[model samples]
Target: MEETSSATMKAAVGKDYGEIRDMVEVVDDQPRPGTPREGYLVVKVLACALAPGDNRVLSGRTKMVQGPPAFPYVIGGDVCGVVHEVGENVEGFKPGDCVVARFFTAGPRGGLAEYYEVKATLTEHKPKTLTPVEAASLASSGTSAYIAVENTIKEGQSVLVLGGGGGVGTMLVQLAKRKKPSFLAVTTAAPKVVQDLGVADHVINYEQENWWEVAEITDQAPFDVIIDLGQGVSAWKVARKYNLLKSRGQFLTFVGDHHVLWAQGIFQIFQSMGPPLWRSAWTPCIPGVPTFRWQLDGLPDKREPLTNLFKLVDEGGLRVVLSNGSPFPFTTDGVQSAMEQLATRKAHGKVVVKVAEE
Candidate 1:
C-alpha cells in the first residue's frame, strides 16, 4: 500500500450514541486511514448510502449486539469510491479504480470518512451504468435482496414482498420478477413507483387498506413465498393467522424484534433464538405453517453477488431506487437529515449522501 500526504481528513463523526442530530457532526480533524492492511483497499469515498443499521448504531439501538462504538465513530456501510491504495495479497483492483463495497465487518468505524479501508472480498468494480450515488446504494441492500430472492423465489410460484418500496424491497421485486412467478404482489406506500416497474400483478397500498383483506391479494392467498423486508414477525403472525401461506411456502424476514432481544440482555438473545430454531425444526411436520426464517445482512462472500448485481444493472434488469430528497449533501446537517429520514422507516427507497464528486 502507498502512503498519502494527508494525515487527517473530514468525516461525519458521531460523538456518542443517542440521537442522529445530537450525536453526528462533520469534523476535519479525523485521522485519515493509513496504508491498507493485507487484503484491503483504502477508498477515496465519493458517496455513502445510509441504512437503518446506521441509524441503529448512531442511536444506540444496537449497542447490546454491536457494543458501544468508539467515540468520534464514523458510521456508514455502503460506499462507492475510487480506490486510493491497494494492500498486498489483493488483486483485480488498483488505485483510481471506481468501486463499490460494503464494510460489513467494520461496524461503526466505516465509510462516512473521506477515506475508508475495506476488505477486497467485499468490494466490486462499479457498474458503468451507475452513478456514484447509485453505486453507493447497491452494496448492502442489493446483496440482501440478491440473497433473499435467490434462496426463496421459484418459477411459477406466487410471491409477495412486504415493504416493496424500500431499498432491499425494490431490488427483491426486480430480481423476483425475473423468476417469472405465476402471481406477484407487493405492499407499499409508494405504489405508483413500484407499479411503474411493471413487475407486480397487484400493488397493495398498505396505508389505504389491509393488504390481507384486499380482494386481489386475498384471492392470491397462500403465497408461495412471503419476503418481509421490514414488517418482521408481525407480518409472519398475520400470515399464519390468516392462512396466507402455502403449506410448504417460506416466510423470510430481514428485520427482527431486536429491540426486544436487546432489552432482554445478551443471555436472552441466545434464549430468543430458540423459537426461530424450534420453528425451523418443526415447521415441516406442521400442517399449514410456512418455514419461518430470519435473515441477517452479513454475507460470507459479497464479491460474487455484487458482480451479479452489476450485471443486472448493466443488463437493464435492475436499478437503484433513491428516496425523495436523497443524495443529500455530505455535511453535518445532511448526514443528520439522512439518518432521521431512515429512522422513519418510510423512505420510499435508499438514502444516500454525496461525499465527493466522481
Candidate 2:
C-alpha cells in the first residue's frame, strides 16, 4: 500500500477557461491520491459523470470558480470509485470500499482525476445492485433533480418537465414518476426515448410541435408544478403566454430563477454570493406566476438524498440513462467528447466517463 505514495496518475486538467480542447489537457504526471486530511478519504476513481455546469466552468461562464484559481485545475462534480485511503476521523468506510461522492469545493476538483478526495460526510456507499457507471451518474444531476422535485412537487398534482431528455431531466422524470402525479408531460425532441423511460404520460416533441399549440401539453397545463430543466428562456415565455401555471403553482428552473441576470455576470456574481434574495426585490414581469431555482446550500442532506435515490434503483423503481446506451472510456479524448456532448444538450441522458474497469 505504501507504493501508492510514489505513483503518478492520469488526469484531465483544465489549464484555462476556454474551449474544452484548448482549456483542458490530459497529463500523466499528476500525483496519485495520498493520505487524506481529517473528515476526508481518498478514492481511486472508476467513473465520473460530465455535468453541464462543468462546461460553464470550462468556458469561464460561472462565478463558482470566482477568485484566483491556480492553473491546471480539474473540474468535475460526481464520481464513484474504490477507497484507497482514509483519514483517521473518517468513519464507516475503509480502503477498497466502493463509494459515490459529490465534491463541489474548490481546488483540483478531484472528479476527473484517476485519484479523488471526498469528504466522508458527502460520500455514500454504492448500492449493491448498481454498476460503478450507474452509481457515478447519480451525484450531481440526480441530487439537483431530487432537490427540485422534493421541494416543490406535491402528490396528485400535474407537472411538466421541459428538456426532459437531458441528464437532470431524465433523473427528474424517474424521481417524479415515483410521486405518481395526476398528469405528467415532458418536452423533448425524442419523444419516443422519453416514453421508453415510462416516466411521462404525455411526451411533447418540441421540435415538431409548439408547446402552446400542442393539445396534449396545453390541456394539462395551468399545472400545479412546472420543472424547467431546459437551456433557454423560451420555456418561461411559453409558460407566461399560455398561463400554464396555476396561481399557486410552483415553477422551478435549474437554470436559476432570474436566468436573465445570468447574462449580467456582475449581478449574477452578486446573487451567486447570497441566497438569491434579489429575486424578491423585483416582481415577476408576469404577475400571478411563481418561479424559482434550486439553491446549492438549501438542498437536503447529501448522503440521504442519494441514498434514497439508490434505494429506488435497488427496488427497481429508478433507472439512469447514459449517453448512447454506454459509458465513455476514461481517457482525455473520452472526457473531451463527453463534455462536448453535454454542451450541445443533445445527450439523451447523463454523459458518464468510465475512469477505470470495475
Candidate 3:
C-alpha cells in the first residue's frame, strides 16, 4: 500500500433546525474525493438536488426518521459528477468518467458538496440523451417512478397515479405508458400537463375535482395499479377506495413514515399476506434487489432495471420535466420559497433545489 493525502471541501450542514437558512452552513475540512481501491471510484460532486423530503427534514419533520439528528447535519441527495479517481484494480471506469448516481441515502454526505463515492452497479452510462443535472434528477426520482409504475403494472391495465404532476409522478406516467397499460388516469395539480405526457388518458386536477370521481374509479371500475407519491390522509383516501386484491390490483407509494419504512423492514409484520406488495398486488418488487455489493459496480448493466428503463424512455415511456425558476429549486436561503412551493401544493412535477451549473 502507498500513502495518499485526503483533500478538504465546502459543504452545507443541517445544524439543528429553526429553518434551513439558519441551519445550513458552508463547512470546511470536508474530505477530498479519493478511491478506496484500484477498482473503487470516487466522484467530484457537480450538483445535489434538494426536494420536499430534504425540506421536511430541515423544518423539524424529524419524527419521520431516526432523530432530530444533530447540528451540522449535511443535507442533499442525488448527484451527477466527474470521476475523480479509480483504485488500481478498477475495471471499466477511468478517472475522468462523467457519471450520475443516487448516492445520498446509501452513504454519509451526498451530492451537495464537491465530492462523494460512487457505486458501479447503481451508476448508469449517462446516455447522450441527458445532461448531468437531468441525470441527477433521474437517477433517484426517475428510477423510483420507473420501479413503481413499470415493476408494479401489467400490460393493458388501467392505472391511477396520485400526486401525479410531481417528480416521481411524472416518471410514473412515462414508465406506465411503456408497460403499454391500456388506460391511464392521473390526479395532479396540473391537469393539462399530465395529459400532455401522452400516457394519461384522463387527468383530474386535485384542486377542482375529486380525483377518484373524475377518474370514475369508484363507481366505474377499479384500477389495476395505483401509484401514490404523497403521504398521510389524502393518500389513505385513495388507497382504501380501490385496493382490490381479487382483481390483482396493488398500490405503490414512496411517501410514508420514514421512521417505519426502514429498508422495507415493515414487510416482516405483513408476512402472513406474503411477500410485501409495494403499492399494488400485481406489481412485486424484485426480491433481493439490494445487497451489500450492489452499489460497488453501480446498478448492474446486465440487470433488467437499466435496460428496461432505457427502453421505456426510448419508446417515450419516460420523460423529465424541469422547474426552471427560483422557489422552484429547494435551498437553504430559499427555505421560505421551498416551503411555499410545497405548502401551496400546486407544483405538478418534481421541485428541486438546484446546487450548481447555473
Candidate 4:
C-alpha cells in the first residue's frame, strides 16, 4: 500500500451552512484520513461528482433532517479514486486498485478530500472504459437509476421520466431504454441533449410546453411507470388529474416538488413527509390509481447493481453526461463554480470536480 507522506490534505470544505459560494473554500491543512478500519478502505480521491443533495447539506436547507453541518464539512458524496489501503475483512480490493464509491456519511464528509475512507461494500472496481470523472458520476446517481429501473421497468411497459437531464435522470433514461420499453418519454428543458441520446421516443420540452397538455405525451397517457426527479410539478397530482397512469401503475420520485421544501422551512419539510408516506401506503387501495412511492433511501447493497451498471457501460449501453465547463479544477473557485451550477438545477448533466491526476 502506498502511504501518503503528509498528515494533512487539501479539501474543498464548507466552513458553515449558508451558501455554496460563501461556505465552500479550499484548505490545505485538513487532516488526512488515516488507516482504514475493518470493512473499510482508505482511498486517494482522484475526482468527485457534485449533486443537488450536496447543496442542501451546505446551505443548511436540510439541517433539521440531517442535523447541523460539521465545521470544515467536505462537500461531495460520489467519488472515484485509487485504493490506498484496505482494512481487515475487506476482499476483492487492494492498494493501487482504481475504484468508485459513494460515501453516505453524516454531514456528508469525505469525497472532496485528497484521501477518504469508504466502506468496501459500497465500493466497486471502476470500469476501464470510463474515466475517473465518469466513474465518479455513477456511484450515487447510477445506483439510484439502476434501482429505479430494476424495480419499475419491464419489457413492453411504457415509461416516462419527469426531469430527465440531470445526473440521475440521464442515467435513468439510458437504463430505462435498455429495458426495451414499448414507449419511452422524458420531460426535460435540455431537449437537444436528451434527444441526442436517441433513447426516449418523445422528448417534451417542459420549458417550452406543458408536458401534460401536449397531445403527443397525453396521447400516450396512462403510462405504466412515471419517475419524477423534481421538475417543479406535483407529479402525484398531475398523474391523478390527467389520468396519466394505467391501473396498478407505479409512480416513483426521488424528490417531489423540492421548491416547496426549499421555500418552506424545516417544519414544512417534516410535515411534507407525512403525505407521501400516507399516499405510498394507502394510494393503492383506490382502484385505477397508480401506487405512490418515494425513492429517498439508498439501496442496502450496491455491489450487484453496480456490477450490472458497469457491464452495461462496458457494452456502450451507458455513458456519463458531463455538464459544460465540467472536470473543474480542484480549487476553491472551481468547486464553487461547480456547486453554483448544480444549485441552478439547469446543468445538462453531472457537474464534476477533478481532485487529482489519475
**Least lDDT summed over 10 consecutive residues: which range in candidate 3?**
289-298
TM of each candidate vs. truth: 0.94, 0.89, 0.74, 0.95
What's model 1's overall lDDT? 0.83
- For 228-345, candidate 1 gives per-residue lDDT tens digits of 8777667888898998998889998777533233422667665656666566668868876788877864576649988988898998867678988899988899988988888887
Residue 282 lDDT, candidate 2, scale 0-100: 40
Give the Cα error of residue 240 in candidate 2, in Å: 2.4
Model 2: lDDT equals: 0.75
Clashes of each: 0, 0, 36, 0
For all predictions, the C-alpha RMSD in Å is 2.7, 3.4, 7.3, 2.4
Which model, 1 or 4, shows the larger lDDT?
4
Model 4: residue 330 alpha-carbon error in angstroms: 0.5
For model 1, the superposed segments whose C-alpha errors exceed 4 Å read: 1-5, 106-108, 257-264, 267-274, 285-288
Which candidate would rank higher by TM-score, 1 or 4? 4
lDDT of 2 by residue, 170-231 (tens): 88987888788999989897787799898888888888888767888777778988887764
> Candidate 3's residue-wise lDDT over 10-129, tens digit each?
555667756644666556555656554543567766655545556555665333332334556566656677777766655667777776666434322345666666556566555456
- Compute the lDDT of residue 279 as modeled in candidate 1: 66
What is the lDDT of every predicted structure here? Answer: 0.83, 0.75, 0.56, 0.84
